[model samples]
Target: MIIEKCNICPHACGGTRYEDKTEGSLCALPALPKILKSHLSKNIEPGLIGSKGSGQIVFAGTVLNDSECSVFDSESDNKKSRINGKKLAQMFLTLQKQGAANINLINPTAFAHLIMEALREQPLQIPVVYSSHGFDSLETLKQLDGLIDIYVPFYKYHHTQIAQKFAEAPDYPAKAQIALLEMYRQVGGLASNYKKGIEQGLLIRHRVFPDFSRESIAALHWLSHYLPEGTGLSLLTGNPYLAWGEEAKNKQPLKREFERVKTALQDLQMNVGYIQDRETGEFFYLDEI
Candidate 1:
């Protein structure tokens, strides 16, 4: 399946994505979805995985291309990993058979249509996670009503200026809010059991930048009010190496800035998920809410 006129994302680039070539698209990705990496990762939010780990598939390209994204090296990755729907379905089953708690589709917004085709190829017993950079189109998400089980999106920033600066998406905050609301309508808050892990849910992840605690706080406030009660959240410190240059990694201290975000979370009474310790870079689930 190829997107002749791509409108899968909010950008509405209206590109013709052929099976082998992409024309006039901002993402510069082909219609055929490409894989960056696939592995069983336990180092994710606990809500998504169990003892076995989540079957994480990192796809190439993104709707909102942030300069600070470190997920994949676009030039080196996906040279020979272009896969069709059947092949992608097979990969999903393979991971499920390998005892993956869930199939986590990372950065999959641009290829959502193809991914939907892959999902239709087979019946998966485990949950399907749609993880992305919170730039999803409501129309695209509406198409995925029954297909996806979990929505894991990064609520990157609250202000339009910050979003534009980082992702070149001036309308990101508004689009993300609407998309998140639709996601919650589909899946609601997290429902996890000891045996089955997460059944279905909406989990919001936020990365607190060292100098952007105020924006983080405002984003958190929006989440607290808009999302359902007890919606799972995952907080992490922004990577200075990605946001700033390599030299800034040592210079920028995240602990203090992280504390401010934590205070905001506490004040909002939105403490029901994972919080990464900035000092040691360790993630601990917050259960003291």
Candidate 2:
């Protein structure tokens, strides 16, 4: 799949993603899909991971120009060979046969077109999880409406200053809000099966930074007001390694702030997902009211 002018992400770089070359593209990645790695793992949120495991496929590079707080920043290593749609489809099939609960595509916005190509050729029996940095284009997401089953997009920041400071995208909050709402519209709320685990849904992730607890609460407030009931959420612990500038200087232990955030979640009556322990590195699934 070759794009004359790539409008895959919110950046709208208008680059040419030819099969052979990437011209003027912000990501500078080939049009063809390049995968950094693939394996069945239980590293994700518990609701998504079944007894077997989730088929985790890490795509190389990203359309978003986020320098900090990118979950898959290490995947930027472009040494991996490019694979066609057919090869990609086969990988899904292989993982499914190996008893994977679902196929999770990480950092896939740049390769969204290629993924559509792969899915069209051969649809999977298991659910397809669309995980990204939450800077998606509406057009690109619309193209993937029926193809994706579960959406695990990150909601990084509520403030433009923090977004700009970290991601260099001042419009990150606006773009992410629109993108996430659309995702929920496509897949209303999280649906789990007794045996299959996460059958389909939208599970938004937000990493609570130490000093930015208020910002985190504000974002949660917006989500509680807009998103439908039973919508899944994952409150992650911010990675200190990614902190920079003022944020790095003022960073503190996440436990105290997280307690406040948890109290806020209860106050908002938005307790229906997972919360990662900053110290223990464990995910506490919250099904309690």
Candidate 3:
């Protein structure tokens, strides 16, 4: 995984991850800060939870990115400090110490390797889990030798501008996917998919963006053709809505498009997980320590 502080994704904010001992880049975060929370939480949806429980970690500070892209929420949820690899390692160490069987990493990328490395020799090691974004190197699928049971990578918006604004993709939904595929192949393939509780390995996850579910669906269709069968797949609904405010409220039409994505998921026979409502968006984390 490329951990160098970057300005590549949608947030062109050009964050300095290595500087000031930060763990993340523009997200105004570099690594897991003093953990605000960590605990075991269940998925309102069963398949989503492949392990006994998932350990959720929330860091402090609003991350500064390349283009100021905000995927989950906006300025309000902004955190405070930058996290570091070792610090992030410690955070996971805390979860392992507490007996968390799985982990749910949101917008993960910053110090992904560090956290996984920390899991290498723990008691309640992570066998199945989710990433906030897409996988960096599927080779970990091989390197870890399938030690990781489940993986859910995201292919958000297809438009270059959206990728420019929300992610750090220069080409987007194309070359970026190619790179992701190569890594997956290196690890295992569809057979590599696993669930800690039942099934496991490489799960592809995508969410509809404002007026961009079409673009996201295109990426999914491409996966259906390109991805090996039996690979784990999950489609998240509009609970993926961005942090709303003035700019967000004005774009009502985009919400309709997101709704279409939910409808499309309902119409499909794919093995997926859907967030039923905001009430079901329950998360478990070690908030303090």
RMSD of 2: 2.4
TM-score winner between candidates 1 and 3: 1
- In every candidate, how many clashes are there? 0, 0, 56
* Model 2 stretches with alpha carbons more than 4 Å out: 68-79, 192-196, 241-252
Residue 116 accuracy (lDDT) in model 3:
62
Q: Which model, 1 or 3, shows the larger lDDT?
A: 1
- Let me know the TM-score candidate 3 reaches against the reference structure: 0.63
In model 1, which regions exceed 4 Å deviation? 73-78, 192-196, 244-253
Q: By TM-score, highest first, what's the ranking?
A: 1, 2, 3
Tens digits of per-residue lDDT for model 1 on 1-289? 5677789999988999888788898888788767877889987776677878899998876666675555544623645667888889999998999999899998898889888898988879999999888989999999999999989998887999988877788999999999999999998887645124677888888877667788889999899988888687888776656563343354434667778788888888876677877766677776552
Question: How high is each candidate's TM-score?
Answer: 0.93, 0.91, 0.63
Distance from true position, residue 127, model 1, in Å? 0.8
Tens-digit lDDT track of model 3 for 1-289: 2346354333434555543444445455543443445566665334445345666664333332322224433323345444555555566677656666655555444444555665564434554454545524333334444445555566555556766565555455554475456545544344422222423556565644345567766666676667665555555444423422234332333556656655554454344333333234432211110
Global lDDT scores for all candidate models: 0.81, 0.81, 0.48
Encode model 2's per-residue lDDT on 102-147: one tens digit a residue: 9999889888988998899888888999988898988889999999
lDDT of 2: 0.81
